[model samples]
Target: MTTTRPVLYLFGSAAPPVFDVAAVVADAQGRGFEVCLGLTSTAARWLEPRKAGLERLTGHPVRSAYKMPGEPDVWPKADVIAVAPATFNTVNAWALGITREFVVGVVAEGIGKGIPMVAMPCVNAAYAQHRQFERSIADLRGMGVRVLYGDGGFVPNLPGRGKPEEYPWHLLLGAVEEIRGAQGEGRSS
Candidate 1:
């Protein structure tokens, strides 16, 4: 099917990404994409739903997995799935095809249907450097997922780590662009 308006599924982990998510949402809206966001239970603590007024902004309701009752079977037929600030837990789950959570279930279904998945991981140096985490990324890639390279080896907002030139909007959207490109090439999930 020819999709005029690309559907984007935005997922944030319990620990929000270092970059701002509100800006990401605005950018996606400006780009003419339909946005639906899923916030991990843990992520909501760091992220304020009121800050973005996410439901109003995305034109779709926003809720955490626990708060949301039943599976969201009729998602917007996403052209791309962007999981930025993907926590170690979320990334691992996606890599393993585990659908225990809301975001995991959406991504699992998306990948199974040939949608491209983009994961932008944010974690402490220790976790990022762990062998298990590394293997999980490998497994995701093996499953045709794209793991975008972020500020590796540097902790966000920490002194001496320096800051990335592009803020949350760019980094997350850039990953989406990569997924869009892969999709145009008929890449599988």
Candidate 2:
């Protein structure tokens, strides 16, 4: 029997790349993931104008709120969760286990469920230097979450100076692919 593509929960925070997330979504699907989108309320607005296109791409509703009572959840169970273009606020809130928004809620629950996750930050260099951001990265990494940053991952861009091409959208997908490969190998071994 043919297996279904693995579901990947693609979360986006309010950042520049969130405006052009379709490219990232296209990349993830190319690497064999079945993508589902969840955005921070703020980020959701950025995509709202093109919501129909995004929905068609993912075959799922882009969720940003709690589902109505007794409404069946439409999102698929994730084999992995990737948060791309994560902002400083989202990083800190997630590390502190705050679930005030749908994106953060998925993160908290994903960690609890032992689902592999990867995050790619899009903070400015100044914001990246914040004590909270540093601590959040450490705390998340300590929990086995792949916080993709630094040399091989996302490097903070200079304030108001970086181009959209500089965001390491692929690193987030690569991290997820690596984790999935590792998990598959584990099962076979």
Candidate 3:
């Protein structure tokens, strides 16, 4: 059966904050989104113990790999996509169009499909200092992604001193709501 609720494809990478995805999913649901959880391969393994519970929460199977050709899609089509706690590798790979990971592949393709997408990176201060990180952020912005980084979004913490608990998941959820609203306006106009 199809759902009337706006569907959100919430993707997470292998970062410390990813462990808190259950709460994030609940929060997204509270905000009226029908969320589908997707993870990078490593993040899937990291949360393997909680996989079944996550499925129960979202009412959909958690996906980490592309389905075999001809396999039917289990989740509803996404109205918006949000990548929270995106890792250093995920950011670079997405900006470079590398689709080895399912999460990156969807977001990369989402650009061409005109799906509103947002991403917030979770990286240590040292990794943030890498020149490529800044360029990737810029590239993603150029491609129309609302990357929640720096100032108002995720600010990297010092290596070995990171606080995953402080990651601003609310910002991503708020952005999704805002994007959905804008899409509605555009459709009416």
Best by lDDT: 3
Quantify all predictions' global Cα lDDT against the true fold. Answer: 0.70, 0.87, 0.95
Q: List the residue pairs that clash in candidate 3.
A: none
Worst ten in a row by lDDT for model 2: 1-10
Task: Count backbone clashes in candidate 1.
Answer: 2
Residues 66-173, candidate 3, lDDT per residue (tens digit)? 999999999899999999889999999999999999999999999999999999999999999999999999999999999999888998889999988888998989
Model 2 lDDT, residue 31, Cα: 93
Query: Which is superior by TM-score, 1 or 3?
Result: 3
Q: Which ranking of candidates, highest TM-score first? A: 3, 2, 1
Best by TM-score: 3
For model 1, give the RMSD to the true fold: 4.4
The CA lDDT at 139 in model 2 is 93
- After superposition, the stretches of candidate 3 with alpha carbons farther than 4 Å from their true spots are none
Q: What is the lDDT of residue 174 in candidate 3?
A: 90
lDDT tens digits, residue span 1-189, model 2: 122998889999989888878988998899999999999999988888988999999888988887878988787688889998888999999999988988998898888899999998888999987898999999999987898889898888789977777677777888889988988898998
